[model samples]
Target: MSAYPSHPRATIGRYRNRGAYDFQAIHSVVNAAPVLHLSFIPSETDPFPTIIPLLGQMGSFANPDADPSSEPLDLYIHTHASTRLVKLVASQTEDGEKGLPVCASAALVDGYVLALTPFNHSCNYRSAVLHGYATPVTDEAERLYAMELITNGLIPERWGNSRVPPTKTELQTTGILKVTIESASGKVRAAGAANDKQDLENEGVIGKVWTGVVPLWQTLGEPVSNEHNRVPVPAYLDNWRKEANERGEEYAVETARKKY
Candidate 1:
């Protein structure tokens, strides 16, 4: 689907202009984020929902060749088989086919906007939230596909370079959660500080207070080898690190310069 249908739970109420329902917008933010926050009700008797940080990726195992920007995809999260979330999903799905309900979110702060007043200060960021059903993957082929996707998503080509196939115990202990998203939305703010007209007109305030955006991005540093390592940093990893740093800094700086 090109865009998710607008639902009350996923729609943005404030600053509606910043909200986007397109698949490209939502998927891009989620995939680029370093980690995702997953919120779910632990049990029927629990009054509060619990949130956990997890590494997740969005892709279609059935259609590996599909384009994420235009095609539908599933969210995959890897964890230990005995984790509470995995066990909970297993128990909930035992009676029926539907899995446990969950909400997943991802965010990236592009820059910090400093305004004259603290109330006016804001951040330039991209965020996405999704509502879905989560279930543990059972099929061996699909599980393998998701494992490879998750591993490579962290570091491209590392899966093949380090290992050929997982050991029996390793495979048995690893758990993969497949989330079929029902509703999703993305919101973004990519502009410099928005100062009030009165503040801008006052020389004392304008001259004294520095109002601008401080660009921020995650930088990949030089790779350090562990003890007993025999090989130098491979060309693939070195090249990826250099290019990623450059692209990240460029995007952050460009976003900081944008005017509201």
Candidate 2:
């Protein structure tokens, strides 16, 4: 599909020009983010919603080679089996519905935009929000697929380089939630500082205040080996780290030069 069907809850109200409903835009933001925040109501009487940070990935076990830009995908999150979210999903399944309702969001900041005034300051960022029904994965094969997908998503080829099949106890203790998306959208801002005409024309302000974008990107440090480890940093890890650093720096710098 080109894009997800629009829904009221998923629509962007302010700055609508930045909103993107295309599959590629939403999937790219979700997949590139290192962490996802999931929110849901804990109980009817709690009076507050619960939000938790989690590691998640978007993929399709049925179509392993599918193109994410053009094809639909499911979001998978792994956590301990005994967690409150997992238990709630299980109960929801028994009630004969799709599963527990949830909202997942991910964001990446590319640069800090500094303007003459505090009100004009902003950040260049990409963010995605998704509403879905999260259900526990009962199929062992699918669960294993999701585990490997998430592992490799973090570090390419890490799953194959490390342990093989997980033990029975490990399998039993790990919970995988597959989220079927209901509506999703992405918002992006990749631009330099936007200064008002008044601020730009004021000689005093223009001369005294420094206005520009401070490019920012996550950097991966050198791998610190365990005390008991004998192996050096593997070629795969070192190569991935170098490539990722280069990509991040280049993107941030390029984004900083864009006009708002």
Instruction: Please write out the lDDT profile of model 2 over residues 80-173, one tens digit for every residue.
Output: 9999999999999899999999999999999999999999999999999999999999899999999999999989999999987999999999
TM-score of each: 0.97, 0.98
For model 2, state the Cα shift of residue 216 in Å.
Answer: 0.8
* C-alpha RMSD for every candidate: 1.0, 0.8
Error of 1 at 229 (Å): 0.8
Clashing residue pairs, backbone N/CA/C < 3 A, model 2:
none
The local distance difference test score of each candidate is 0.91, 0.93
- Candidate 1 on 1-260: residue-level lDDT in tens? 59876799999999999998898998888888889999999978979999999998898988998887788789999889999999998987896968999999999998999999999899989999999999989899899899898878878888889876999888999999999999999999998889999999999999899999999999889999999899989998998898888988998899889888
lDDT for model 2 comes to 0.93
